[model samples]
Target: MLRPYREVLARPGALAFSSAGVLARLPMSMVGIAIVLAVPEVYGSYGLAGQITAVYVIVHSIAAPLLAHLVDRHGQARVMMPALRVAGLGIVGIILAIATAAHPGWVFAGAVVAGASIGSVGALVRARWSYILRDPAAIHTAYSLESALDEFVFIVGPVVATVLATSVAPTAGLWLPAAAVLLGGWMLLSQRATEPPVVRREAGASGGSSLRSGGMVVLTLVFAAVGSIFGATDVSTVAFADELGSKKAAGTVLAVFALGSMLSGLGYGLRHWQSPLWRRFAIGVVALACGVSLFFVVSSLPVLAAVMFVTGFTIAPTIVNGNGLVTSFVRPDQLTTGLAWVGTALGVGVSIGSAAAGAAVDQQGAHGGFLVVAASAAVAVVATFVALPTLRAGHAPAGRGAGPADYATVVPNSDPSA
Candidate 1:
């Protein structure tokens, strides 16, 4: 298991950029929860806090692809550095507004700024991996490592944010993410050697978006459904714990869920399978759907936690393959934009799923929320099968045309022709 990770990280500049990326992307998991924790103390309204957080999420989802496009047009450092500064300022503005007890409008404005500018460091990091690594197996391993890192971030970020907010100060929750983004962003942007080269468009050629590709469209929609499962499960788990008189254990249960994904992702990356990417993705989706269906039958907190841990296994492999599919469907020139779309889809789906599950829980309890989770998984399964032909076509002849041999061969570092 560790051997594959070692092989990938041994690449020049890989460890530095990937480590920096983990730091920078920490804010992705932290910001929403931080806002939720910080806002209510000053404003005395959970409703207001949720609304502000929603603004941040929605704006970030809309802005990530645009920023990625700019990165493709210019370069990572040139675009992301300014964006990081703006995001930092936005966080500062929010903290100040909260401290001063300023009007709600200022808080909303700050969220908009922060969201629009935070960008997608994860997408940027993965783009770098795609640029530097030539072996398909190495690329697969690298993506898996990143996926595990993401789960690790989600596991640790919230606990730290929560502790700081409750024990230290309400505004303190926001400070960590702000500092993290700045420090991490600086570390990543300074590593010029690993940055993907900008591929300029040809004379008179159209500036086509990644979404125009059928495979990309299918992926975005399917990932949206996957995100919905995540959102619904989170809300329902909290509600379920509350129902069982063990509300404090909710965090533990959720952490177990993340742990399952982290472990599976690490293991999944170790393989050099001969299976087609589309087939693997389809199987992963179906497994996730089956895992989610078990939630409806869970009756106790202990059982629910166990179920969540088992279900978590399906999350990372599905996501890893979904991202891998982007490399297959999208041109190398538009790779970052295509990857950002997956993140955007997940963000949008999370928002929608959480809202829908919240409503369901209100009407019928945790079981109702689980119903939503099941429904979302079912949708993902349907979408995957329905678009099987497109996925199969897109994944056939990109870089992995020769199956396991592609994993053995290493192409040169120069960019492939657009």
Candidate 2:
């Protein structure tokens, strides 16, 4: 398990950028729960909290692909540095608004700014991996490692956010994400050696958007459903723990969930799959649906935690395969944009799920939110089966710039010896 990861990280600048990427992407896990905890405590309404979070996530979903396009056109440092600054300001605005008891409109405005500018650091990092590594097997291992790192982020971020929110100050939880973004963004952008070069288009050339591919569209929608499950689970678990008078324990429960995924991700990376990527993705989605359905029946915190851990087993494998399939559906030039679409779909689903679960929690408590989770999973299952034909025919159309085969250029220091 460690051998593959060691080989990948052995490439010069790989360890540096990936480490920085993890730091920068920490906000991905922290921001949702921080907002969920802070807004309700300050405003006394879970519905309002959810709405604010929805606004942020929805705008993020809209903005990430656009930012990624810019990155593809220009370069990561040039685009992401300014975007990170704007996002930092937005977070500051949110913190100030909440602290000063400013009008709700201020919060909404801040959310919009923050959401539109945060950009998908996860996509950015993965793009770096794709740029630097040439081997298909190496790429698979790298993605799996990133997924596991993502789980690690989730494990630590929520616990810190939850503790700060409940024990120190609600606003305190939001601060860490903001700080991480600044520090991590700088660290990542400063390492220019591993960044993917901008792929300029020929005059009059039109490769079009990655969304033009039917398979990509199908994958996006299915990912949206998966994202909804994530959103619903986060809000529901928080509420459930609160209801049981052990709110702090929400972090621990969520950590357990991530632990399962992280462990699985580590194992999944080591395998050499003989099956098609789409088939693996579909199976993972089905397993995820079945696992989440169990959430609807849990009556205690321990039971919920146990179910979450089991359900988590399906997440990383599903995501890694879905990302792998992106290469199958889009041109090499569209890699970043394509990956950002996956993140965008997830953000959109999370917005919907957060708002829906928030409303449901307000009406029927924690279990209501769990209902949304199960429902979202069911939607994912349906979408996956219904779109099976399209997913199986995963090649992009001809004249789409070049297929992912053209994606594997030899970047400097890509070798383990380097």
Candidate 3:
């Protein structure tokens, strides 16, 4: 089952890059939470505290593609080194500011610096693999494995962050991701001897500018829908736990929910599809939608766990397919930037969804939040269904539609002649 990953990691620099990904992400998840815990010590209002946390994610999401473009244009090591130190310094500044109760503005500013400096390591790491794994099958396998590893990061990063916040100072754990980015970037640079050289693939290609490609537009829509649902579902699940009068159940429910996703992602990595890309993707959509719908009906924690477990089955493969489409639809050189665009889209969507879910929980209740989740899934289903014909053809119709163009024209690799 693990042979494909084992085979891929055996290649020069692959393992090193993977380790860098872990190091970079370890602190990434906790960055927002750290802001939440620390800002409150400075300011009592939760809203102000939440804003400080939100700024980091919002800024990071907006800045990721720009940073990725820098790396795409320059070398990854060159772009990442300075950014890493900035992030580390930002972490220390935040710790000092909050410890001294100097100013809330300083805390917010430090968070932004940390965020902006953290460049999208996931995107950077994936781009590295894209340059190395040229074959379609190998690329798919690499992406699936990388995503599974990412899930592990999300799972572990949060738990560790929570523990650190509880046991150590919240600011202390902040150093991990910041330092990891630098450490990992340096480790990755050492592998430059075996690395794929940088390219200007757009310098003389014959395709029109990538801005109007159909695949990219579809990807944005798909991710927006999926990510929003996740954000809403997470907050809603906690709300439901509260509704049941078991506040502690929130953590238990979430763990099961994540466990479901982790196991399903594992299955997705190991299983080979016998169908076409669009067909598999469509099936994944159905599974995802069904899972979303189930949340509203299941009230008991155990049943919710069962529902969540079932719901988990489709997420990893759907995302894997969505990412796999990137290579097929865009030029080879644009892969990292393309995926960065998609990941950023999902991040934005999740932010919106989580916000909406939080509001729904506060106003309408868990049922209402769950309903919003179902509705979001329905939107994604409709969006993907409408795009299926064009998707199945493996390319857009006569003229490029929105998806391809959306990703293609963006920074990092955008050019008219390409």
Best by lDDT: 1
For model 2, the superposed segments whose C-alpha errors exceed 4 Å read 40-46, 239-247, 361-367, 395-418
Error of 2 at 252 (Å): 2.2
Please give the CA lDDT of all the candidate structures.
0.88, 0.85, 0.72
Query: Which prediction has more favorable TM-score, 2 or 3?
Result: 2
Instruction: Give residue 256's error in model 3 in angstroms.
Output: 2.6
Residue by residue across 241-350, what tens digits does model 3's lDDT show? Answer: 88889866776666666666666666666655556766777788878998889899886878887788778767777887777766566664455567777888888888
Comparing 1 and 2 on lDDT, the stronger one: 1
Q: Which digits, one per residue and each the tens of the lDDT, describe model 1 over residues 1-418?
A: 4999998899999999999999998888888888888888988998999899999999999999999998876778888999998999899889899879999999999999999999999999999998888888899999999999999999999899899999998988889889988999999999988888766554554457889889999999999999999999889999999999998898899999999999999999999867888999999999999998899899888888898899889889999999999988766768889999999999999998899999999999999999999999999999999999999987854443222122222222243431
Model 1: weakest 10-residue lDDT segment is 404-413
For the record, the alpha-carbon RMSD of candidate 1 to the native fold, in angstroms, is 3.9
In order of appearance, the predictions have TM-scores of 0.94, 0.90, 0.88
Shift in Å, residue 240, candidate 3:
1.8
- The count of backbone overlaps in candidate 1 is 0
Candidate 1's TM-score reads 0.94
What C-alpha lDDT, on a 0 to 100 scale, does residue 179 get in candidate 1?
Answer: 93
**Number of the top TM-score candidate:** 1
